[model samples]
Target: MGATINLLVMASMPIAKVLLLAAIGSFLGLDHVNILGEDARHHLNKVVFYVFNPALVTSTLAKTITFESFLTLWFMPVNIFITYLLGSILGWVLIKITKAPRHLKGLIIGACSAGNLGKLPLIIVPAMCREKGSPFGDVDVCQSYGLAYASLSMALGNFYMWLYTYNIIRIFSRDVIDDANHPEVGDESFGNNTEFLLKPTEYSLMTPNNKIPMSSKFQQLLSQFSGKINLKPLFSPSTIGVLVGFMIGLIPPLRKLLIGNDAPLHVIQDSAYMLGDATIPTITLILGANLLLGLKGSQIQFRIVIGIVATRYILLPLLGILIIRGAIRGGILKCDPLFQFILLLQYAVPPAMNISTMTELFGNGQSEYSVILLWTYGLAAVALTLWSTIFLWLVAS
Candidate 1:
């Protein structure tokens, strides 16, 4: 009982910090306060998105990652994918059960599928490791590796969130826009538009009179290939930051030059670190301000909110335990206990804060998503504390 209480206290500290920051944000965003009002939040979000996030990704990954660490943490990507698959299935079910509106269905799925693999774990793991009586030995060593694991998790989470959940929200929300614009046509017009986007130029290998030349056919094939692939998401600022970080971290010469105190160019990395430090607080503040909209009474359904909270907190964590433990039993995951714990923690986090940004970008479900986030994150302190305690006990034992 003493051990459990100790673990619970350790777990709750990071969550408490997050809530405190968000509380300040919420307070500032109030009509009477207005420091973090809608306009202020919008501008701050731009700064965080364009500046802070990329800097954080680049500095953290460059500092923590190396060729060896990459090999050791190979299975993490697979584990994250499994969480997305399971959560997505649950999200789909919730959408159907609630009969969520077209605009909100994507938000629902986005919330379920994209866990907050970035900020929360980055905050929680290192903080827990520093606490008294941490299950992982030697505070310094534990915190160092824990930060690395969390950084890599953030990088990969950004990759998946942008490519997968971003597109889902974009497509669904666009459909809603199309329907509104052309109420009589419905999906047919949208389908045609999508087809047009995918295959803008029709390719012909044959004509009524003669078969097309191989050279022309090659060009046609190239067009089709390029048309189907949307690489815009791949080049997002955060994604580019990840790629740059990987380049610096994986190559010993580059890593040594940029990352270490002895290196001549270490100032670059230090600058990045300074900028990156603002990411968590700025994001948390924006989240709090967004929640103000939810408090103002949005059209979101109670059942949808409850369903997402249950799926994310209850069903996902239990399934994550089974998957992580089963992998250990089967000898597929032979990493250190801290790494295992991070994998488990990934499943147990709140939805990605990026989901709200996506909805805002697409002009759909901004208020609804804010409401969903408010409930999930409001309850997150308890949920994460409970699951973190269980995960700590499981891994430590």
Candidate 2:
């Protein structure tokens, strides 16, 4: 009982710190306060996206990751993919059960599928490592490894979220907007290039030379696939940071040049670290300001809210435990206990705050997405604390 309380306290402190900072941001965003108002938050978010995030990702990953370390942590990407896949399936089920509105369906699915992989873990892991009696081990070593795991997690999480969740919401939201504004003239315009590729077979059959070459058919299929999927988000700044960091860390000569105190060009890494330090606070502040919109409330259904919460907090975590433990039992995952803990933790986090950004970008469901973020993040402190405790105990055992 005493050990359990100790772990719980350790877990809750990081969450408490996050809530406290967010409280300040929320206060600042208030109409009376007017410090981190909408405009301020928007600019700050861009800074984080373009500057702080890349700096943090590059500095942390460069300092810790190497070719060997990268190989050892390979399961993490697979773990993140599993979480997204399972969560997306559950989101689809929820939409069906609730009969969610067209615009909100994508929002709901994106929420379910994308966890706050970067920010929360970045804060929680290092904080947990610093706590006395941490199950992982010595504080310094634990902090170093934990931060690396978290940084890599953040980079990859953003990659998947942007490519998968962003496109999902963009498609659905744009469709809803188009249907509303133009009922009669949908995708019937001549410029709809996707139409020709989609009906290539129909077009080919009509031709006198009825045998379309295999190469032509392959190119047509490729075009159709590319047309449906947006790949631009896959190379986001954070992801590029990860790639750059990997390059520096993996090569022995480059690693010696940039990473250590003795290196001549170490100033660059130090500068990046200094800039990266601002990422957490800046992101949390933006989060608080954005969440303020939730306070205004939306017409979103109560059942939908409950469904998303239950999926994230209850169903997903249970499945995570099973998958991770089964992996260990089957001898598939052989790495640091902290690495496994990070993977399990990935399954338990709340929805990505970026979903709100997407809803705003798509120009619909902004208020609705904000409301969902509010409830989930409001409960995240409790949810994360409990799961962290369980994960620590499981990994320690």
Cα RMSD, each candidate: 4.3, 3.5
Candidate 2 lDDT by residue in tens digits, 1-397: 9999988998899999999989989999999999998888888888999999999989988998877888898898999999999999999999999988877888989989899998988888988888888888988888877887888999999999989998888777766666668575454322254333346354753346656566766777676556657888889999999999898988889889998899989999999999999998888877887788988999999899999999999999999999999998999998467898899999999999888888878888888878898999999989999999999889888
How well does candidate 2 score on lDDT at residue 340? 88
For each candidate, what is the lDDT? Answer: 0.83, 0.87
| lDDT value for model 1 | 0.83
Candidate 2 ranges with C-alpha deviation above 4 Å: 181-225
| Candidate 2 RMSD computed on C-alpha atoms after optimal superposition onto the true structure | 3.5
For model 1, what is the error of residue 3's alpha carbon versus the real structure, in angstroms, after optimal superposition?
A: 1.0
Task: Per model, state how many residue pairs clash.
Answer: 0, 0
Position 155, candidate 1: lDDT:
76
**Model 1 quality (TM-score):** 0.87
Candidate number of the best TM-score? 2
